[model samples]
Target: MTNTNIQILQFGTGNFLRAFFGSMVQDLNENGNNLNICIIQSTSSNSLQQLAAQDYKYNLLVAGFKDGQKIEQIREITCVKDGIRLPDEEEKFLNFAASSQLKWIISNVTEAGMVMKEEGPFEKFAESFAGRLTQWLYKRFQTIPQSETVVLPCELLPDNGKLLRNFILAHSINWNLSSEFLLWIEEKVLFLNSLVDRIVPGFPSHLDLKLKESDPFLVQAEPYALWAIEGPESVCSHLPFLSSDSEVILAGDISGFALRKVRILNASHTAMTGHGLLLGIQTVGEWINSSDREKFLLDIIDNEIIPTINLDRDELKKYANDVLDRFRNPFVSHKLSDISLNSIAKLKSRLLPIFMDYKVLIGYYPPNLSLCLISMLLFYLRTPEKIRDEQEIKLWFKNVSKSQSEIDVLKTALATWLDLEWNSSFENAFNKVRQ
Candidate 1:
C-alpha cells in the first residue's frame, strides 16, 4: 500500500487519538480510501527529536470484552506521514496550514487547551491552543482564498468547535485581517461540535506479555464506540467516510446527546472515582469489583442524576447501563486519576447539569450532588499547593466566609456554586462535609 495525499492532519498523537481517530484512518485506508495522516506533536520541545527520528511509527494494542467473550486486536499504525514538532520549526507548521489536501482537523488537547488567550495570532511562543489555531486559519485563508476547513475538535468541552471558531474570529479582529476574510471565516468554514465516546486507556502492561508471546504486537479496544456530530444536515452529506447506522449521529442539536454523555457516562465516572479512591481502588475494574462502588454510582445516576435529564428516560438508562458494563471490562485498565484531570472543569460539565436539572425538577436541593460540590471546593483549595496559583485559590474562596464564627463557609461555597440559596445550615451540611 502507498500513502496518498494528506487528507487528515491530526494534531494530538496521544493514546486517545491513536485508538480513536488513528484507528479510523487506518481502517479506512485498509478499505482503499488512500487517506494519509500527518501528526503534529503539540509539545515536543524535549522529545520532538526522538519522535521525529522514529518517523512517526508505533504499535497499538487494544483489548476489551464483547458479548461475554475476550477480544484483542493488534496492529501497527503507519499512517503518520510526517511529524512536525511545533517548538523546533514554526515555518513548517505554518506551511501545513495552507495545504489544499488537508480536509479534516481533529484534536484532543484536553479542556483547558480550548481557552482563548489574549495574544495576537502570530505570537512566537504558542501560548494557547486557540491562538495557534487562529494563526493557522489566517494562513489557510491567505493561501487558499475561497476554501473552508472542516474542523472537528474531540475535546471534552461542550460546543468546543463553536468556542474555537469564536476565538479564531476574535483573533482576526486582533490581527486586523480584512472584513472580506472575516466574512469568509463566517460563511465558509464548518465548525461542528462533537461528542466522542471511547474507552482508550493506552497500552496495557500485563497484556503486553501475552501479546508478545502470540504475535509480538497488538492494538485493541472495547467493542463500543460512538461519534455524535452536531451540525447542519449537509455535514454528513459531504463526508461519505463514516459508518452507516448507530455509530455516527447527525442531529438537529447535539446538546441532548452531550447531556446524556456527561450526566450518565462522565458523571458516573467521577462518582465512582471519588468512592474508589477512598476505597484504595486504582483501576475501573477494581472499582467495579467493589460491591458498593458500582451500585452507588448507578444509584446516583438513576435516583439522582438521570431523572433530572431531559432525554427519554428508558433510552437513557439503557445506554447508561451499556456504558457501565464497558467500564467494568476486566481487560481494559481505565485508571481513576486519568478521569480526574482538571476535575473542576470536568465536574462543571459532567455533574452540574444534573444538579441544575434536579433543582428545576424536584424544586429542592440535591444533597449528594451538593456533597460533590463541596468535594470540588476542597479539591480546588488543595490544588494551589501544587499548582502555585494563589489567585485562582482566592477566586474560588471569594464566596466563603473567612471568620470561624461563620463556620459554615464550605456550605455557603457549595450553595453559591449550585446557584441555590438552599439553607446552607441544613443538618446534612455536616454529613456532606464528612463525605
Candidate 2:
C-alpha cells in the first residue's frame, strides 16, 4: 500500500484508470512523490469491494509499438490506499476531501456522469457522481483553507471540467449555499479541462486461457497515449506529480488539442467501429491487418476530417499516421462494441464536426460520415433489443419511439446539433438506408 499522506482521489477503478491513471500515479509515487490514492465508486453499491480488499492491486498489460518494435509488458500497480462507496462511505470521502494532504482529484465517470439537474447544489446526502463531487467540494470549502483543489477530469467530453464546475455552481445555487462558498469555488478550486487518449482494451479475462497458452503473460493496449490539460500557471507549476515527460501538456488553451483529438483520433475510431465490424474486423489489429480498412481510415482522415479542422494539416497528418500505426498493434484486442459504448455522445462531439464541416465547405455530405450516422441510429434503435433487462430495454425503446423514424430523426437531429442545413441531397443520402 502507498503510505503517503498526500493523496489522490480517483473516481473510477475500471481498466482504463487501472492501466493509464493508476500506472501513472504509481510511477509518480515511485519517483519520490509518495502520493497515495483513494478510489471511490460514485454509486451506493460498492462493486469494487473485492478489488479494494486486495489493496487495489491489479495487473495491467501494455502491448503494441514502442521504439519501433512490438512490445508487451505486464505490470502490477499498488498505489491505491483504499476504496469506498461514495454514498455509503460519505463521511470517509468528506473527511478525505477536507484533508489538508489531499492535493489532486480525478474522474473518468463516462459522459452520463457529467449531467447535473436543476436541483442546483448537492443535497445533504446524494448518490450520483456529480452530486457526490459537489458535496465533496462543499466539504472542502467548509473545512480546508490556505489552498484549493486541482481537478483533472478524464471523461471523454468537450470542456468537461467547465461543465462539471458549472454543475457544482448550479447545485450551490439550488442548495442555497452562501456567496462566500461560491466565491471560494470560483477562486480556489481549479478545474482543468483535459483530453485523454488511450485505447486500453481492458482486462481480457475471456481470452485468459488462450493468452496463457500462447504467451503465458499478455496485456492489451494500443501503441498510443496522450493527455493534454488546459489550466492556470499555478496548476502547471505544481504538476510534477503527474509525469516527468512532455506527453502530458499543460497548455494555455486546449481548444487546439480538442480539435486535433476530435478530428483525427475520435473521428477515425467511430468511423472504424461500424465499417470495421461490417468487414469482420474484431480487433484493432485485424482492422490494421487489412489494407482496405487502413486506406479507408487514412482517406477519411485526410480528405473528410482534416480539411474541417483548424490546425496545421501537415502536423496533424504526421500525428494521424502515427495514430494509424498504433491501430495496427498486434497484441491489443480493442473491440468495436466497447468503443461504440456512447455512440450518441461520440457522434455529437467527435464525428458531427466533420460531418457538418464537410456539408458546409463542400456543399455536399460525405457518404462515409453519413454511414456513421446511420450506424449510430441503427445502434440506438436495435442494439437495445439484445439488452437483458426489460426495464432498460423498455427505456431505450421509449427513447427510440420518442425519436422520429430512425433516418428522419437522425438526419434532423444531426443537422440541428451540428448547426447545418437539412437539404434535399442530405435527406436523400440519409434516407438510402432504413433502420
Candidate 3:
C-alpha cells in the first residue's frame, strides 16, 4: 500500500497494539472507514519482516469467559499496510510522517519509553523514541503545516499524551527548531491522554496443535477491551473508531477510568506478583485458582483500594469483580514475572497513592497494603538477582545485609525507599504475616 493510504502511524510493533488497536482499525476498515496503518518499530526486531512475510496479515485470537460462557473468536487483521523500523528505514519513516492522510499517531512504547533524552542533529535519526518522533513531527510540520494531527499515547503512565507533547516540545527547543514549527505544533497538533485496558499474553503456544495455520505474528488476548481517550467529542469525527460499537470511550476526563483500572486491575497484579511467585504460581490464572491467594487479592482491593478511591463504591466493586474475572481467564497465561518488570515503579504508581490515602483516612496504613509492600520487599530481599528493576532499586536490596533481621530490614526499606511511616498496627500485621 502507498504511504498516502496509511492514515495511522503507530509507534511500537508489539503484540498488545496488534491485538487491540490493529483489531479496532481492522473493524473500522470493514465498516467503511477505509483507514490503514503503518507500524513503526523502534527496537531491533524481526517483527516487520514477520508481518511482511504474512502480507501484513495476522490472526488475533480473542479467547476468554464472557457472560458466563466461553467465547473464542478469531479475526485476520489487514489494517496494517506496511511497517518501517526506525534509524534503518529513516527516510521511509519520515515520509509516512509527512503523509497527507496521516491523522493519528498512536504509541505504546512502555512506561520507560516515555523518557526524554539529550540528543542532537535533527537531520539524523535520534536514539530515543521521543527524539525520533520530534524529527518525524518536524518533517510533518515542514511538509504539511496546515494539516492537523492527533497523538494518542497508549502508555500506562498517567497523562501520557501531555508528557509526550512536553517531551517533543523539549526536544524541539533543545534542537533549536524554528518558532513557526513550534507554533504549528501547539496550534494544530492534539496530544491526547488515553488509557487502554486489555490483557494480551501474546502467542497462544498452548493451542499450537489446534491452530489452523502457522502464523508467527499471531497474538492472543482476553475478550475484554477498553480504550478511554481524554478528548473533545469532535475527536470521534477524526477517529471514527470511537463511534463504532467497539469499547473505545471518548471522555472529557479519563482520570476516573484510569484510576479505577490502575487501582483495581494493575494494583492487584503488582500486589500479587511477588507473593504469587513466592508460592510457585506461574500465571494469573494459577493465582486466581488458589483460594487463599484469591482471598488475599480481594482483601487488598475491596478493603484497601476501593475505600481510597472517591468514585462510587458499587462501581468500584463491580470493576474489581470484573478484573478478577479477567484474571480467571484460563486461556491467557499472564506471567507474574512479566508483571514484575520495574516492580518498584509499578508499586509507586499503582499502590503508593492508595497506601498514603488509606493512612490519612484511617489514621494508619492499611494492613493488607502494608503486607503487600512487605511481601514485595521480602521478595526483593530473597531474589535480588531475579528481580528486574532499575539498578538503584536492585542495589538498595543488594545492600541490605543478611545479618539484619527481616523486620528491621523491611522497616528501614519502607522508611527510606517508599517514605512510608512506621506504625504499631503495621508492625503487628507484619509480625503476624511472618508467623
Candidate 4:
C-alpha cells in the first residue's frame, strides 16, 4: 500500500538481483525516474519476510578491483517498495501484476528455475517458477491487455528469454487458456534475452562485525557488472536505467557476449569448483590465491575454452585475465558450495558446450577438461550429502556405491549420465590427477 508506483515486478529476492538489478533501479530513481520495484519471492524462502521487516530496503556493498584500482562502496537500496511471497501471497502478487503502472518483469531464478515441472491446478499456485509466471502473465493479460510489459530474464542460460516465453505459452495451452491470450502475449509482450554478470556473495558474515549497522539482508558483490540485453532500440525506452551510468547493453544480438561469459566466467567456475572443493579450498579467493590451482584453471580457459569460442582471441584473453582479478577480490567470499548448486545443469550449459567444441575445434578431446569431469565425479562421490541439485540428480549420485573403484565410477558417470565417451587418454589423465 505504499504510494510509490510499482513499475517493475521482480521474480526473485536473491543477493544477485538485489545488488545488480535492484541497485541499477535505485540509480535510475535517484536520477529522476520514479519507478519502484515489487519483489515476488519465487521460492518458499524467508527473504520476503526479512525484506518486509526492513521496509524493503537493504544495504549493498560493492567492493572489488575496477580499472586496476581497488574500490569499495556501500549504499542503501530503497527502490523496492513492497515484497510478496508466491502461493502464500498469490492474491497480492496477482494484484500487483494487474497494476497498469508495471512495465518490466525481471528474474534471476538461476539455471534450474527455467525448467518446466509438473504443476497442479491453476487455482492452487503452480510449483514451477515458469508455471507461476504463466499464471501471473494471464492475470496481467486479463486486467491490462493494451499495456505492454518487457520481460528480461537474467538467467545464465543462452536465449533465456525465448525459453521462458515458450514455457509460459506451453503452460497457457496446458491450462486451456484462450487463443487470444497467447496472441496477446505474442503481440504485446517483449521477452528480451539477457546475460547478467556479477558475483554477489550473499550476507557477508565475515564483515558483520565491521558493519556500522545491523542488517539481516546485507548483500556484498564485486564492482564489475554487465547486463547485456538483446532487443530493439525501442526497448530502451521502457528501461530508464539505461540512461544512467550502468553497463546495460541493448544489442541486436547478445549471443556473442553470452557465449563469452558462459564459456569463460561461468565455465571456469564450474570447472574449478569440483577440484577446488576437493583440495579443501573454501572461497574463490583461496582457490585463485593458490598458484597450482590458479594455473590449472587458467590452462583450461586459455588452452581449451578460448580456442573453441569464435570471438577475437585477444579480447577473450583480456576477459579471462579480468575474471582472475575478480576472483582475487579480497572483499568477496564467494563459496564454491554456492556455485556448486545444480552443478549438473551448470556443467551442461556452461562446460559441456565447450567440451564438445574443444573436440571439434582442437581436433581432439581436451585433457584438462577431461580432468574437470573426473574431478566433478570424484567430488560427487565423496560428498553426496553436501550436493544440492534436482532430486533425481542427487539420487543418482547417492545411488553410486562407494565400493566401486574411481575408474569404474568415472566411466559409468561419463558414459551414462553425460553421454561422453571415455578413452585411454582420459583414463591416464584421471589416474595421474587422482594420484
Model 4's TM-score against the true structure: 0.94
What is the per-residue lDDT of model 1 for residues 1-435, given as tens digits with 9 covering 90 to 100? 113367776777666776777777777677777777777777644444554565665566666766777776667777777766665656777787677777778888776567777873355645577777777777788888676678889887789888888888887788777898788888778888888888877657546355444432234467567788887777775554475322767777888888788778878787666545544467888878877756666777788887887779999989888888898887788877666666555666677667667868987556666555555455544333322122444576553445643336645654655444545423464465565
Pairs that collide, model 2: 120-171, 121-171, 121-172
Look at candidate 3 and tell me the lDDT of residue 272.
82
* Range of the 10 consecutive residues with the lowest summed lDDT in candidate 1: 381-390
lDDT-best of 2 and 4: 4
What's the TM-score of each model vs. the native? Answer: 0.84, 0.85, 0.88, 0.94
Question: Positional deviation of 52 in candidate 1, in angstroms?
Answer: 3.4
lDDT of 3 by residue, 1-435 (tens): 346788888988888899999889888778888888888887766878878887888899999987888988888899998888777888888777667888889998877677888896877789888998889889889888888998999988889999999999999999999999899999999999999999988888767535536787888999888999898887777667785455998999999999999888988888888667766677888888978878888888888989989999999999988898899888888888878877877777888888889879988877877777777877888788878776788998987888988888888887877777667866866776577
Among residues 3 or more apart in sequence or in different chains, the pairs in candidate 4 whose N, CA or C atoms overlap within 3 Å are none
Point out where model 2 deviates above 4 Å: 1-6, 43-47, 120-124, 205-219, 277-281, 386-394, 398-435
Q: Name model 3 segments beyond 4 Å from true.
A: 120-124, 388-435
Candidate number achieving the greatest TM-score relative to the actual structure? 4
Q: Tens-digit lDDT track for model 4 on 106-137? A: 99888888888778788878888889888888
By summed lDDT, the worst window of 10 consecutive residues in model 2 runs over 385-394
Task: Output the worst ten-in-a-row residue range by lDDT, candidate 3.
Answer: 205-214
Error of 4 at 286 (Å): 0.9
Clashing residue pairs in candidate 3 are none
Candidate 4 overall lDDT versus native: 0.84
